[model samples]
Target: MSIYEKIGGEAAVDAAVDIFYRKVLADDRINEFFDTVDMESQHTKQKAFLTMAFGGPNSYTGKDMREAHKNMKLTEDHFNAVAENLVATLQDLNVGQEEIDAIIAVCLTVKDDVLNV
Candidate 1:
């Protein structure tokens, strides 16, 4: 099975996105970046992106990571905050460490792009 399947596929990815965003929005450190954003649309985009990233069958047609985040002047702290939320959300849903590690690794691959470094 693909890692997506192993990590519970569509349903799990959807739930993790939902939970992860809640944490992100609630966080004062990162909440400012989303003040004027459309969350529902962002949610949809995130779901598709993560599904594809995790070896699932989905086409992510959103802006590329660098372009998407280029104007944000994002820092490592912002990235870490977002990643922490993701990890916590997955852990809350009982995803295994191995799977979580894989997820984190995949997320890390885009760090430079996200930070525009």
Candidate 2:
């Protein structure tokens, strides 16, 4: 099955994103990046990105992650924080370890896309 199917689907993606963004918005280190963003819109974009990355039907079609994050000067520290947040969100949502690992593998595949360090 595709990763999307494995992870559930749109509903699951939506839930994961909602939880992830709530944490990100409240996180001091990453909050600055989202301060001026429309939370709903940003959340939608993130959903699209994650869905596409995980083999869902949606097309991401957003700016390249590297370009979108270039100005932020993202580093390993920032990436690790995001990863931790993701793991927590997955656990909170009761996603299985196998599924979570699949999702995380997708994220890891794009490390260069979101980090400069």
Provide the TM-score for each candidate, comma-separated: 0.90, 0.86
- Local distance difference test, candidate 1: 0.83
> Model 1 off-target regions past 4 Å?
58-63
Report the lDDT tens digits of candidate 1 across residue range 1-117: 888999888887887788878898899999999999898898887787678667789644334788888789898999999888888888899988998888888788778888888
**What RMSD does each model have against the real structure?**
1.9, 2.1
- Cα lDDT, all candidates: 0.83, 0.79
Clashing pairs in 2: none
Candidate number achieving the greatest lDDT relative to the actual structure = 1
Give per-residue CA lDDT, model 2, range 1-117, as digits (tens). 986887788888888888888887888877788889888888987787768656789644324776777778787878878878888888998878887788888788778878843
Return the TM-score for candidate 2, rounded to 2 decimals. 0.86
Candidate 2, which segments miss by more than 4 Å at Cα? 61-63
